[model samples]
Target: MIHDTNDAIPHQLIHDALERVISSREIVNSDRKKRFLQFIVKETLAGNADRIKAYTIAIDVFNRDSSFDPISDPVVRIEAGRLRRCLEHYYLAEGAADRLQIIIPKGSYVPQFVMREVAAPTLLRALDDDKQSTSERLPEIVPAEAEFSQAPVAATSSYQPPGTAPSRVPLLKRPRLLAGLCSLLAILTIALAGTTLFQRYQVSVSSRAVPSQVPTLMVLPFENDSSDPAQNMFAKGVTEEVIGALILFKNILVLGADTSFQFRTETALRDAVPNVPIDYVLKGSIDRTEGQIQVNAALLRAADHQYLWSGSFRKDFTSKSMLDLRRDIATQVALILVQPHGVIDKAELQNTVGRPSESLTSYECVLRTREYWRQPNAEMHKQVRTCLERAVRIDPDYADAWAALAFIYTDEARIDFNPSAERPDPTLTALEIARRAVALAPDSPLPLQALGIAHWLRREPALSIAAYEQARVLNPHDSDILADLGRAYSLTGDWEKGIPLIREAFDRNPAQPTWYRLFIALYHYVNGQYAEALAQAQKIGTPNLVYTHVVLAMIYGQTGDRDNADYEVDEILRLYPNFGDKAVFEFERRNIDPAIISRMLDGLRKAGLDMDPDREVANEKD
Candidate 1:
């Protein structure tokens, strides 16, 4: 007997069943299906059920490489489904008489064995003795070939107990009748098979035909867990506030309040919208105690009920106004769950692995853009550029794709990300793309952000600030926009307003990128707070950007750390060999306030970077 605590089925029995099914004519024809079944069953038998995951199956059974990502490539999932149907057909036909049956349950790879009931031959033999009289008492007999012709055996194929055998009238003795029955069964079998094939074809087309779309989320109504009727109203208010805040994000699609409110529980939501493939659900409860509002919220992956993120927020309403408290909680929660590099973006990145650019949907292109931003580099930026270009070609109406592509164009022009590539004019190209994005999505914050960046690149600081401010108004929870607007303000020497805005953006987004700290560090350095500025600059790690090194060199130089300061200058020169000439040129062309530029240059000069135009020309001559 197998030593599995859950099942005591004999090991030999399972092995016999596996051999019978795999060697059967139904499974023997297809190598892929046969191997799929054999691999999972053997692994299960060997007590290696844990190794039967989709990733392992793709590698071991399908010859996929080590970089196989199950989410983007559905080969294993598709094969597992086909194998399951194949097993059903096998058991209903040739393996029906076997005492043990091997079955692979849905949504899992582990194989199981169940006992097949044996028929009592003696009961049929007794009825056959009195044929003439038994004919009247017996139910009409259906031929096994006719009965098992269908792929899925009908429920009417129920087991017959030993003593309750139906009387048998042999149709085989009437050769004409048997032949006609066989012909009819053959026609039915052909029609059923054709229908099944057609259905499978349709499923195959539907699975791959649809373009990848933005992940959708459904926010269930928050349950009121307090006795006060006012708390019930507050709960509903919070739910609506969250829904409103979530909808402001351009990437994710939040279900309408009407649709979301109809189902409060996850089970109820699934039962109601069986066909709606919601990717995530926001659910929680609200209660009030001692004049304080306590809200517990969790973000769940709708497919598996896995909690992707959860939070418990407590606010003292006695110290703050009720409306302010509600808005504050909703905005904070929304920012954490949907902002760039937040919970949803991180989860979506995992699903987008190994997907080729040409096959990406518009939404997937946008997701890929975020991946590039997470670790902004030249190689990944080119990949993202290709993806967005394809996305816009395939889905020209996707505003988010256009906006992301606009950023790529800006990067190419402003930073010379692809310095090898020559173009007539990328700055105007970026402006045109940004305008197109805004034309497509006038109300979306992402489009406005792209427009703002384009304007900034064009040296139109006022226009850039206007666009950033409008975008912030559109999506107040977007930390990137706030940060952009803050940087714009600071560049124009409105440090009073800019510093506070940047600080607020930082507080709102816990996952704000390392560069957001750059502005804060500069802010400290500008205020002559060397210790605080150095601490902040060190926290930024070694980012691959010339500005990061410049700021660090500035801070180190001010603190009289000559060694580290020289190292920072060397790193900057490594990135930009002719820093002396480039710095003077960039300072002349950039839209930054002249005073701020001069101050930053002063600090860089102190860090051992000879920022003299005269000496740079002399060195070239030498």
Candidate 2:
């Protein structure tokens, strides 16, 4: 009914495309994203595209109050970006061969339904038919022109200019023109053929190179071995809860319950489904002893039925509700399996052992960056940076790769990492790269984490904290984000709130870097516990940072150990020769508490560090 062009897309075709996208459990998993897409598509179909503004979406679809301001909140814009990405991924995968495309162009929310371009084989066949018809008509055109030339012109009867061989131009023009056109067509055909071959060769080379990919998982039907028949329902509920929790992790894909429950066991799955695409399968059993229920979970590699990890968790159902018990156990299992440095992450990293850097995919680059964080240094940072740079170049749409690369830039800008290596405007570059990651994956917490670091490097702690809080809301179990938020809060003089966050992070993932230990030491030092602070400081390993030595010197000085304090002060000066001169400036730049900075400088002076600029400058020279 809204047709204004010859090739208007059929309403049924548009609706079919929408169905294909929204029905894809893997692609558009978020109910919010699905709703966003459906609302815009229905609006466009109803000839109300103009009315589909951010305010309208917030009010109608998102259920926001009328007081919502787009500029301030930007929730609509953010979710719109996410929805657009989901649609793009859907088209690239399952909808690749569809006859129509539903695209939401940037800068607007209106959905455009357009007919897909002609298939390559069909287009080539059409071109061949056109060429054949042109060749067949060439003869008739030539004869018609010859007859016209032979008929002669009546107005030229009196022209008697002798010579010129009776004007041979008309006789030779057609053949020469035809020959030139044929030669041009032949050259084009050869060039196109060469280009096609080159492209195919590139594809072949890419295919031969093995790149790491995102791991997929399936939660199989759980077996109930308990006496109570109602425990069967409990086991099913746990499986469903686990599937729900695992789907939140962006790095791993979780197959839906409908698909995963078809087979009872791994062997049945393998025998029934050919070449199962899942990498890991989680299956568990439920058993009740007395008032307590026990859940034993096992993770198995789908390819060979090899068990990767197994754990037993028990909960007292009498003390807690059944729903809460299932959720708690599911969360524990999810955290153990999917968190950073967890089983799947370690397995994936191990799987990248023999792969060359050039063949490393975006996800592999991200995983490698995680390795660098655990053992941060100049050499490893450089290697990680190069890997991530190549990853973004290879796959521009990989948001995690972009985010990881931005983190490197942020470190370089803030810490002056490898100062001898000349670089330009790293701060702005870091922020821009982080923003690019956010734009690429608006709903992902990884990009938001990178954005928070970039903001912190730019000396915007408030904005940094805001980004981190949003990231925590998206994925509360990410320990790295929690530690980062704690660092932010502590640096801004909120130790009461910050220390617990840091402790929680450490409890969640104890295998973190030594820099985290420094925070705990500082927390003790602030509370006037010198022995505790000193003990915590000793656990920090080398290549130790300046802040680590500074804290050590302060704790030793406060505890009346002049020799150890002086040794720490000497280490600091040896590492940073003019630290005394820039110590205050550095502390302020890092957003430390004023009182803490004063106390630190006083302790340093007590430990024989001269705060005088002239003396520090002379020391640097000597």
Predicted candidate 1, C-alpha RMSD: 30.4
- Candidate 1 lDDT over residue span 1-622, tens digit each: 1134157776777778888888775566456788898898888878899898999999999999999987656567656765776676555434545667677777888777767566323211221332233234323531222111212111121212112233442554322345457546655775877654322222211211113367878888998888877567567767867876786676787765555555666577557435556789999888889988899999999889899999989988643255566667887788889988789998988787887777666787788887776557788888888888766655545667777887887877665687424434566456556655665555567877887887788777766786787677667778888888888888777888888888888788867666767778888888899888887887765367777898999888877889999999999988878876678556544566666676677788888897765532112222
**Candidate 2 clash figure, as a count:** 0
Task: Give the poorly placed runs of model 1, Cα more than 4 Å off.
Answer: 1-212, 266-273, 317-320, 420-422, 614-622
Global Cα lDDT for candidate 1: 0.69
TM-score of each candidate structure, all chains considered together: 0.63, 0.65
Write model 2 residue lDDT over 473-554, tens digit each, in one string: 6677777888899998997789987888888887877665657778888888888888888888898775446777899988
For candidate 2, the per-residue lDDT at 353 reads: 87
Query: Where does candidate 2 clash, by residue pair?
Result: none
Lowest summed-lDDT stretch of 10 residues in model 1?
Answer: 146-155
The prediction achieving the highest TM-score against the true structure is 2
Model 2 CA lDDT for position 526: 80
Q: After superposition, how far is residue 137 of candidate 2 from its true place, in Å?
A: 66
